[model samples]
Target chain A: MSLLAAGGLAVGYRRGRRAPLTLVADVDLSLAAGELVCLVGPNGAGKSTLLRTLAGLQRPLAGRVTLAGADLHAMDARERAQRLATVWTGPVEVGLMAARELVALGRHPHTGWSGRLRAADEAAIDAALAAVDAAELAWQPVDQLSDGQRQKINIARALAQEPQLLLLDEPAAWLDLARRAEIMALLQRLARQQGCAVLLSSHDLELALRHADRLWLMSGDGTLRAGAPEDLALGGALSTAFRSAGLHYDALEGKFVSLQPRSGGPTVALHGSGTAASWTRRALERGGYRVCEPGCERAARAAVKVLQQGWELRLGSSRRRCESLESLLSALAAAPVD
Target chain B: MIRAQWRWPGATLLPGRLHSDPLQRQRLRRALLQGGLLCLVLALFLLSLMLGSVNIPPDEVLRSLSRAGAGESAWERIVLLIRLPKALTALLAGAALGVSGLLMQTLFRNPLAGPYVLGISSGASLGVALVLLGAGGTLGVTLVAGLGLGGSLALAGAAMTGAALVLLLVLLVARAVGSNMTLLVLGVMLGFLTSALVSMLLYFSVPEQVQAYVNWSFGSFGTVSWRELRVMAPLLLAGLTLAALLAKPLDALLPGEQVAQGLGLNVRRARLQVMLATAVLAGTVTAFCGPVGFLGIAVPHLCRSLAGTSCHRTLLPACMLCGAALALVAALVAELPGSNLVLPLNAVMALLGAPVVIHVLLRRRNLRRVFAS
Candidate 1:
């Protein structure tokens, strides 16, 4: 059975006594144990509303959300918290509390009213710290730590809950490239080792594609397309979902191509096959040159040979060895176009 | 030379471990600090009892306190009748305001939030102002002469009602407002509205009534009698107990309300309980002590700095001990032992509290990160 399942789920907000405006509806989503899913979407695409609803933080406008085969909304807050934990993107004010103390608070559902951690609770906190590789940070004050270190503690706090399902809302939003990749890898490892389902909304589409086992792509028309990242890319679902003027998703490169191919531009015949050849092709294309293969019969303004040492530009029998791509572009500009 | 290491049997994670844990060491230090604060409170309590207009000796104060009715001497009356109740009132009221201030700060997640910031004290003052200034010509002059047990109860009851009403309004606004900052602004507006009503009442009232109101507004810990203490003590104790019991939720709230909810705390219910606790505490002290200032806003910041941790389990008790000590010191200073003149309680509190808060702010650069955001 799936760890979490939601069918016909609708989520949005209500204003006054008027009709509730549904941002997205008829959503069917499920997460199996040990699976990592990433929710990808544009702004105002109801990713937050959907994530909040699935986590039982907010009521779903339409249908049922079940966690481990039990109705999520029917359970008391503590019962639901014991099974599911959420990590948010917002910065937390931990005041003067130590990292271990903050992590121990995740035992709120298991402990008594005083939230005193027992022996079992202490072991869980230790395991959480170790899982996040943050044992060294356990004694440090949370406010004193850097943002990435604090985010590790935040994830550790959630892990201490010992939940079967974890939901994170753009947990890597504010982090830089290395830190963002670290968090994504950590979540993936947690799901694999602990056999808990991990689902997170992310604005970093490339990271999501690289790390997620499956992607839930939300379109502007309030539709969702879920499949393997490569499958979605190959099926053109990613491009269709994020369709905007002059924006295209390149499947081979696994990136969004926003620069359109220029029309009726100067032509260049590119030669050689290696990393240098591929990069030279890119630079030539970006420089508004129509780069042709080595054997194109079309009339060419300039012919370029990518040598082992440097780029050799032959403009009407005037050969010039360009040392760099910058110099090559500048040399190409200096060459006269007939 | 080998050093002998002390360890609790069956307590160490490893049987041969020699070093103690950092958390354990921190707990020990806080425990010692709290003990010191308790001693300070007791010493200040003694000082408050001993030093007044006509200075009474410690032995006389203790004798009067221990063995009641042993003698009807003037010293005994001064210690038993006047100073004892005044000191007890300061201790209880100060502790109450301190805990309430902590609750308000946590609930709103703002360092500037307190009973005064939320207009709770202003509500109490408006209630008292109505009784003393608006209806003074008919009712207050007589009530003022002998604010005996019954008349003081009436004032306390009125103050509680007014505070409850304002708290209800704030809670309603809290529900509608999107952020803590908005709720704080609305609370300040409510305070302004209540004070405006009070000023208008003062404008229309007789000069005698206006003087009565002004005297009440200066605030006094000495006005509470033995009878009033009987009423005030139970209410203040109950509020403090509630605040202590709420330490877990308040600590969870340090990260903000959404995370507190994620931790399985019933955020709405906890908020209601917190505001109710604040109302009971701030209301009771304002009733008998006449809107004592600075203690509510200052004591929590002082205790937070002294304790050096945001965990309210330690902070609540520390606030109670430190608040009682600070209030006793202020009360003693206001007494002006050698002189016949008594300084106003609020003036002494401002003189004492402002510097401690300023110093704490200057020393702790992370105060903004801890509370403002």
Candidate 2:
């Protein structure tokens, strides 16, 4: 069931024959068919290194990576490419090669030495383009593509490879928020429909958590943790890997937010439900107030209540009613501490 | 909109799709371009034969070309024995250099790269310098006697050896260094080292020997006699064949070696083949034509810009024809058609090619599109 398996793998650059400078040590990972696994980590957490090692672009410092139960490194590029395809981050230098031509390169393992694209190859390229939602870009020069468009084409190129296991390194690193989510969703659909395992590394935690069937968490300490996305998020593994001193993972929100920084300021209990409470919490946090007891109106010590009318601040004998979130923040700021 | 029209050659014209007959259209268009360029090459070839120290009429030139069994006239002897070989030499040299430059440019992914970017010309000069200046009295290859049997053969042989050695060094460095830029810089450094060695040889040689080396350095297409063409033609053909075979892999390489390897190419093997191809094309041309300049570096760029695409399938043949056409033009310019005096070949090439290079540098078109993905 495992399309790709990396067992006790150590990734690093080698210096002659002595030993390699191992960056990620003893990584045990497996990708099954028809699955989407996203690799997430902080900067310099060896995500690219682990991905590169799995892709067979670099020699692992230790251990073995097998594709279809055979040693990955031992296979020729053509044979390896047939089983495992990787899409690296772009801007890929291209000399006016059409997006379709770029995708057709994926047929190298299937085509003859002359690299003439056949009818089947053309079909695969068209299917790939359509799959990645880049059908219109098929005839455009890859050199002239926008970054987001280029990333879509890169995915299409990998799809055209027709590999059982697809790996990508930061495929949407440069896209805007909406495009990032779209790319992740596209990768998930590609895995499900194409019946190929797709493994990609990304720093977009929200998109990764929302779309990825499973998660591989690479930490700064060179440890790789893998589990279902929700399991990993709730299990505190994602937070441990990515959340630094100033950042904290909000499990309910499935996103990261700034840690309150423990300012010795007075605590304010903001009480509300839905978007109002969330925005009030954000404003209180931004206003330098330690917003505690969220949605707990009865907590007593100076608390603000969010009624349909507005924000009613009750500060020991001094009550202020404000309508807008800005006025409420101002009142909260100008109000005396209990 | 412009990008769409430009990429029509590679558009995915799937069967029964809206886009129709791209392969057929591409072939027809390519045929037309090739026909036009081939005609130009022939016209220039004829012009090359007709205009020289002694002018021959077009009718006479054709008469001699067609009726070979007739009594050889002064014009026939001149056209057949002298002009025909020189023009063929220029044509072959130009084609070889053009393809070689295209390969080098693709290999290095640098536009400034040419056949001599790898110190091949300097190596050939080093070879000729060693024979002419270092061992002048023994070899006895005089500037006037350069076209003679013993001297010309020895000079060409020495030049080829020197070129082979430099090519071998470059290929060696290319194998060791992973980066194309590093290999390219190493080539330039190798040129400097060889040039320094040649300067030392020049300082110690006699005046007559120095004069001979200087004249050889001036560069010429007419240096290849009929005997040399027999050797140069086959070698250039082999190089051209290698370039054609490498078209697909080289297309994968336009993005660079990493992508080529990703496309299931054996990068090391492809690079070795490219180097071998360049060594043959560049080395043979340098041996026969004294390092014909500009055609190698400029012709491919001219063809690529005109063709509006960098598909090696189209651009390779285009480079060949453009290279031949440009070389013939350069040959004509060097001949100074009306006057008996001939200009130094490099001088004319510089006058023509330097502007194009400067223009490309100034215009800076499609550079980042090729560099940044």
Candidate 3:
């Protein structure tokens, strides 16, 4: 079933007599149950704002968000809460509650006005904790946990709600590389196993590309592009979304690489393939020499050169002498004053 | 570790495992234990009524209780009239302050946020100062005392107004600065400003009026008349009931306002309701009991420590009961070594409450670890 549908959505914020900051513009998207989508965008690209609006945390300046054919705007807060759960970034202060107790708060909607946890509620909490591998930490205080562990507990808390849709704003912001992977894997598992429609905003483009079932690309110009990860990557959307000055995408390598400057120095031959040329090129640059055609002049008197897998040095009116890069550096430093 | 194993009746135990089922059972047991604590507090409240100045036997106390006018002696009249009202007022006032503190702390997402932290009590003090010191006469004194109660209530209204004003400021600042700590410091500064204004009013008052104000400031439950109780009781009950109704939303709020809104609570309305409830509670208690200190800030933390949970479902009631118990105990102690020499209830509460506040601060590191994200 289609869990959420946003039609002709537009969001903007007005700041004290200034022009409105337009975030999302005329976006249409539909998310189905058991689908995991990652929203990737640069800072201030409106990913967080879109997620908040979808979760009903923020009202859209103009848009219609419907869950299961019912307009979200028409639903009361409590009714909307029954279908959606969110895990927001930043510290949560709930006094001295234990992890399990915190997770049980997810059952607020299902529980009675008194908020008594039934046996079914207890089972759900246990299942959620166990699903997130946080069962052992249930009795531990939430404030005592590591950041990564706390993030997992928060996810577990959301899972305990058993909502149809889950929205997370930068859930992996504080996690290390390994923990980040673990959290992504956990989210994927939740989407598959629990049949939840999950949408999370993250800055980890590479990880999101690898793990997310679909990608929602929020551009700097207030537009959203949604498609499969491979489709986006192949279509150049990924590169375009993250483009900045001096950084170019390598389609074959699937990563960014810095363009190397040409070397300029005295005529010298170098014999090396990939590794040797790369290392020597780096060394020459560090020594303030640039690589160029052999006959090119304008090389400084102090410039060092490498040719045919060997270093060459030519002082004023002196013949070029071959030496290792280390010896060449030492020779330049130790040379007699002219 | 004391790994005490408590078995629920007719439940099968799985050997060599953590017994996940047992954990659920343990929670149920813990809830029952909290219930027992509440019952124990009720018993203590009854016991408090029996101990007093005159050597009226327990039987005579019970007899006086069973029949209203049968024991029309001065001793019975004093016990029924004076001490009972005072003790009950202390209980209600303390409970109100405790709930107010809990609500404020939860709403602001700060452990230190309370009636005093928000300057609500100080606002009440300012109102009392205007009544007692601003205008001076014996007739003015009677009028101020009457108006003082109403003025203190107005002070509470003013406090709510101040809180709303500050909330607007904080929200604007939060958008501009995007810093939580700065907003907290701003609240503290607002509170300081109100207190400074109250002190200025106190400085210009006449000595006799100052003495009366000072006595009220010391905090006592002995001043509530039956008539005042009639007004105070319903207000406290109604405010507390409203607060209790907010428990679920308030629990969502603890995670932060944004989270609460995402959970489908109108954060603005919830916050306003909480502020109004807290103002009514703290204001009414201060009006009747003369700005009693510490209970509004301390009891919530004490309940959290005892119950090991922050879910308002348990924390609200636990705080209410514990606050009443603490106040009742304090009242009993105030009346001890003979009821004639009553110590100010505020002094006793401070002696008890200050250490708990310091302890919460000292153990904040551990608390942060427990709730860290």
Candidate 4:
């Protein structure tokens, strides 16, 4: 079942005596239960605005946002909060609260007068902590936790709410490569385990592409496209929105390839595969040599053979067997230009 | 270290007893500490009553307190008219200033935020100045008692009105302003504006009127007679109660306003409520006791460090008790035993308060990050 569905949505701000400025217009998206969706865009691309709109943190300018079958804007904040939870990086004036206390705050909507925690609240908090792999951090102070640990705790806090939908704004924006992958994987597992739809915005496109169930590609033109990650990758939608100078989508690698194509340079034919050929092609491309396909599909002044035997460079009538790609490139450099 | 984790026992988590130790221990320790602090507050209350210039024998002071005699009885008059009210005034004023400071610091998320830092008292001063000087009189009423119950009541009322107006203006401006430094700077500027207006009033009024205003600005707890205490206590308690009620959202706020809002707290309403509580707490105290400095800014920080957590749940109550204790100590020191000379309350507070504020600023590595953003 769809937990949140936005149709004909528009989001932005209206300043004093000015017309409302839309950031994301006509955004149509639906998040089903247990789906992990990633929203990726450059700065000021309205990724946050879209997340805020979907989470009911901000009102849609012209569309209806239904959360758990109710109009998001029409519901009271507390009522909406019970069904939705959001996490983001901002200044937190954390007093002496432990990690558990932070997570317990997720139970705010369920808490009664004075916010006293009942048995169910405690059980939910504990289970949420366990879900996010943050159970061990329960007693530690929140401010003292590392960045990755903090993000995990943040997710646990949201999960503790037992909401039908979860929205996080860049939960892992400040971690190392390995940690980012871990956080992404954690979110993916959490969405499935808790059966709650999870949506997050992040600058790390690679991780999002690998782990997200769906992708919401927000562009600078205030438009967004939502589709399965593989479908977006296959349809060339990922590269279209992220394209910039010297950057193109590498269809083979499913990642953006930033290369300075050397125009009018003597080209060489790549005669191998695997890591050796790919790296050699990269090295040749970096040295201003265009590496053509093997069998010389196009005109080639040189053929660089990279095999288990060694790198064999045949430049016109002069053939040089070099020990490595470095020697081959150097040998190619010494070859007479046409 | 004082982050007391008192868990409500009725709630049991999965693997039920795994997390019970810290919660139960912290709760037990918190109870003991709070109880001990309560005892300390009472002891200081009694000490404040006993150690004054007259040095009335403790027994006589107790006797006079318990049973009143003739009109000419000096001990009875001293204990009843002077010490008891003064001590109570110190407790209420200190708690009020401390909690008010906590609210401002939490609301703005700035370490330097407080009633004094925000120029709240100066606004109160401006109010009193209007009543004393701008009222077109050679001599007029102030918060201190030169007149009867009616006069003191009128003075308090004027001061509260002035404070509320200034507080209203500050809260309105704070919503529009995002950065903590900008708000603090705005408060200082507002303080300056009120002070400037007050100076103009002083220039036009008689020296006797100016003198009354000056004494009022000097800051005093002893000036509040039993009658004025009646006016300040209920309001101070009410403000303190409001602060306690706000502790949860204030904790939610620790992660910042946006997160609090995400957690379902109405940030705008919560912010306004906090400001209202501060205005009432600071306004009433300033009206009754003048603008006592430093306690409002310093006490909250002091309590936070001692409690080892910023959770308003324990911190708010801790701040109140700690503030009461500090005020009593300050009151005792100002009394100057064995000498009839009483130190100016404002000067004493500044001397004590300035150090704490400076210490906190020095200790924080990211001063600019906390306020400038």
Q: DockQ for every model, please.
A: 0.70, 0.55, 0.41, 0.49
lDDT of 1 by residue, A18-90 (tens): 9998888898988999999999877888899888888788898898999989999998999988898999887
Best by DockQ: 1
- Candidate 3 achieves a global lDDT of 0.74
Each candidate's lDDT (Cα)?
Answer: 0.85, 0.82, 0.74, 0.80
Docking class of 2: medium
Which has the higher lDDT value, candidate number 2 or candidate number 3? 2
In order of appearance, the predictions have TM-scores of 0.92, 0.89, 0.79, 0.87
Error of 2 at B278 (Å): 0.6
Report the C-alpha lDDT of model 3 over B220-312, residue by residue, as the tens digit. Answer: 777776767887799899988999898887887887776666656677667667766887788778767777877887888777766666778
The TM-score, computed over Cα atoms with residue i paired to residue i, of candidate 4 is 0.87
- lDDT by residue (B1-373, candidate 2, tens digit) is 8776675454555343434555455556667788888899989988998998888899999899897647977888988888898899888888999999999989988877899989999999999888888875645445346554557777889999999999988888888888878888999999999999999998887777878888888888877777878888999899889888998888878766766777778888888898899889998888877867777878777777666567787889999998888888888888988788999997898798768756874576755555442
Tens-digit per-residue lDDT, A33-122, candidate 2: 999999988888888888887888888888999988999988888888877888888567677677877888777778886788888998
Clashing pairs in 4: A92-B254, A92-B255, A93-B254, A95-B310, A96-B309, A96-B310
Query: Residue B37 error for model 2, in Å?
Result: 2.4
Q: A1-338 in candidate 4: lDDT tens per residue?
A: 68788888889986769899889888777999999999987688888878887777777789899987889989888887888899885434355668898898888878864778899999999999999888899999776787788788888888888889989898877788888899899989988887889999998888998999989888778888889888888898877877753467787888877755647777788888988888988899888887789777359988988769778887777777888777887888887777
User: Candidate 3 falls in which docking quality class?
Assistant: acceptable
Compose the digit string of candidate 4's lDDT tens values, residues B1-373.
3458765554554345434588765665566667777898999988887888877777777777778554648878888889999999999888888899998888878776886656677788888888888776633744334543566567777888888888888888978876555777888898999889988999888877877888777777887888787777888889988988987777777777677777888887787788789888888988888888778878877766656566677778888898898888888888897789888887887787678756865676334433334
lDDT of 1 by residue, B189-286 (tens): 99999999999998898887888778877888888888888888999999988889998888888888778878888887888788778888988898
